[model samples]
Target chain A: MTETILKVDNVSKAFGALRACDRVSLDLRLGEIHALIGPNGAGKSTLIKQIAGNLRPDSGRIEFLGRDVAALDTVERARMGLGRSFQISAVIAEFTVLQNVVLAVQGARGTSFHFLRGALSDRAVTEAARLQIERAHLGGREAVRASDLAHGERRRLELAMALALRPKAFLLDEPMAGMGADGVAEMTGLLDGLRHEAPILLVEHDMDAVFALADRISVLDYGQIIASGTVDEIRAHPEVRRAYLGEEDAA
Target chain B: MGRETLLNAAIALGLVAVPVWAHLAGEPFIITLTTKAVILALAGVGLNIALGHGGLISFGHAAYFGLGGYAAGILAHHAQTFTPLMSAPFIIEGTKFMPVIWLVAVIVAGLAALVIGALSLRTSGVYFIMITLAFGQMLFFFAISWPAYGGEDGLVIYVRNEFPGLNTLDPIQFFALCYVILGLALWFSHRFGRSPFGLALNAARQNAERVQTVGIRPFRLRLTAFVISGMITGLAGALFADLNRFVSPSMLSWQTSGEIMIFIILGGVGRLYGPVAGAALFIALEHFLGGVSDYWLVFVGALLLLVVLFARGGIIGTLAGREVAHD
Candidate 1:
């Protein structure tokens, strides 16, 4: 077994009467894409928020590199290499693509205290930003303001920012969301290659992409994991069919 | 140079030229009016760092301004009276030196901002604005009730503070000193908006959650900007008190905070020289319109409404075009 880079052990979250996540236990090992799939209200967002440090679990421990990170905030988690991409693209609308990527690079390298020098002028940050921009296929549009970018391009920009973190693991929420067929295909290839750099905890709606990329699949239903297994095992799982995946996939 | 840069240069030249031309025409009062504009512009510039770049609408900035004025006034008062600032412990003495007064004002204001920002930054938007206003009002009433500083009657300085070789008593000399300080402030503001810290702060303003996900805490960034902003405004307050030869509770009033915010809105919220343009226009309107009618501020109010309704970017944004990415 490869080393477990991220461990989510018995995490539970409740909002009033509704439990968002209930005793969720999952882990991402090095160099694997572990896909979390569910219906609209399957508590995927809540789980991702808990993992990303945006929401707190009522009980359970989240360990990154064998150390518990339940006390950390979102900023602290990001600093500790827990890269996250939002479902709705969250790039700085006013900043150019390069600027957005440079922010992530600056954050990762701990250069935010630099008051005198321009972030762009810093060769180290800019170079890293450029590399990530290229990796995310945003090479020619470096100077484009994030707001002006096409929907697919904005998603790519998020990926670029996430990559710039040099993260130990990625908690990507719907990276293929709002993309056309071509965009989905391109992102699928990108996520396919991304597993080598860092393990990915992908929360995606696209079944095609998830099935193609995920070494292991976790099917979430009403804040509980109905099934957790390899792609073939999850496909064949009877409980997963009734709760999620639907009768269509099973047939 | 860019269009805004050219416009800024023109405004700079116009500010200097008007005072000089007024001095040549023997219109000392006009020069004084221009000096007031410069000092107010400096205050606006200070607020812009927090309000504009950091998206922190600090409605209580007048607290720093008033504290700065009181620092200069109290120091000069004690200096002339030959009394130590404190009788016990360290036995610190007061001096009527401009640099020392300015230093003290900046430090005091910065410290105040640190405390205020620590509490206030926890809430955002309207809550943030109200809390800041509350803090400013608290200071205002404190100053009004404090008998040692003459309460609401205010403190008067017999002479302006000294600044090395130049005679600060001369209008032009004093104007020159203010102009130099304003220039330094504008240069700093320009550079600050492009720096790494500025980038992070700006990002935090636009999308704080995005900023956090990028591993930067918006609270620390905003607090730092607030302190720096307060320090700058405080410096302006000292200059303003020196200019008037009086320090009063009115300097700490909510109306003063509104006026500083007006300077930013009138010029351009985040524009480098937005406050400069806004301050100059505001003073000009007050001077020219006050002579015409007692309700001169009505016209200013109307203009502010028009700016808000039509030109959302304010004066510089309307004139120079929409905000462009500096990078």
Candidate 2:
């Protein structure tokens, strides 16, 4: 088996009386898209938040790149190469597409303390940002303000920033949340190619995209992983059918 | 070149030319008035770094400004009296040299800013504003109770502090000195706003959480901007004291902080030359309206209301269009 790049060991969290995540254990290896799918309240977002260091689990451990990261903050975790995208697109609204990506490049490469030189004129950072922007298929809209971009383009811009992190693992939270059918198809193709760059832990609601793109699917229901397996096995799991996918959808 | 750049050049030239014309026409008071505007504009520039770019609204900047003025006042007072500033820890004598006073003022103000920013940056929005205002008030009262420096009566320099190779006592010369310093400050603010750090600071302002997700801490950026802002305002405060040959607790008051904020708002909050325009308009309003009525500030308040409601981006923003101000 490929060496595990990210490991979540029995992580559980609760909000007052509600258990958002209950002893959830999962792993992402060297090169694979691990999709975490569930109904709206099944605690997928809560799990993603814990792994991204935005929330602390009530009980359990998260290990990234064979190192314990229990005490690190969101910024530190991102620096350590765990890139993430928000469920709702969260690009800097006033910044141009190029500027937003340039900031991400600057963040990942280390210190942003260079105070005299113009950020856009820095050839190295700007070039890297351009590459990512092109890869995300937002080539011609470099100077367009993020607020002015179309809904799908903003999602692409978010992905561009995540790619600029040059991360070891990606913790993507619903990459296709508000995208249209065409946008989904294009994103699915884009994500299909992204697995070669880094292992992705995708939390998505689009079942067709999930089924098509997931190398391994984990069925989450009521804050617990009901089943985990390859697409065929997950499709065959009886309990997963009852708890998450109905009989018609599972078939 | 951009229209804003042209406008900035015209404003700069006009500032220098008016003072020169007044000197030739024997109106020394005009030069003094222009000097005051320039110094106040420099303070506004400092606050802009925090409020405009970093999205930090610091309501206590007068603390640094007053501290800077006191640094100059206290130093000049001791120097004129031929007394040692301290004797126990180390023998430190005061100096009247402009460069030395400026250095002390910058360092003192920068240090205070560091402390205030470190604490105040912990909260944001109204709480941030309130915390900063509280700190400023603390300094104001501290200055009032410190009788060694004349307490509420304030301290006065017997002579204007000396600058190298120039008679600073001359109104035109002093105005020129202030103009040059203001020019340097505007240049620095311009460069600082476009730098890589500035980009991150701007991004942090727009969305701090997004900045964090990209592995950048917004607090550090904001605190740095605040300290730098405080340092510049402190420098301006020192110069302001030198201009009047006096330093008072009123320099540390909440009213001073509000005036500084008004300067930024009047010009265009984030625009590079916003402070310069704001200060010019303010001084002009005060000079013209004060003659008409004792309640001149009410008119200024009305103008501010109009700008906030209709102008959105302030004077420059209204003239140059909104697409390209800070950038």
Off by over 4 Å in 1: none
Clashing pairs in 2: none
RMSD (Cα, Å) of model 2? 1.4
| Runs off by more than 4 Å, candidate 2 | A247-251, B325-327
RMSD of each: 1.2, 1.4
Q: Model 2, residue A30: displacement in angstroms? A: 1.2
Candidate 1 chain B, which ten residues in sequence have the lowest lDDT sum?
B318-327
- Best-matching candidate per lDDT: 1
lDDT of 2 by residue, A9-116 (tens): 999999999989999999998889999998889999999999999899989999999998999999999999998999999999989999999999999987588878
TM-score of 2: 0.98
Best-performing candidate as measured by DockQ:
1
Q: List, residue by residue over B139-211, the lDDT tens digit for candidate 1.
A: 9999999999799999998999999998998999999999999999999988888888999999999999998
Per-residue lDDT of candidate 1, residues A1-251 (tens digit): 78999999999999999988999999999999999999999999999999998888999999998989988999999998998999999999999999999999988887887777877898888999999999999999998999999999999999999999999999999999989999999999999999999999999988889999999999999999989999999988989877777756658
What TM-score would you report for chain A in candidate 2? Answer: 0.97
Candidate 1: residue B128 lDDT (0-100): 97
Chain A TM-score per candidate?
0.97, 0.97
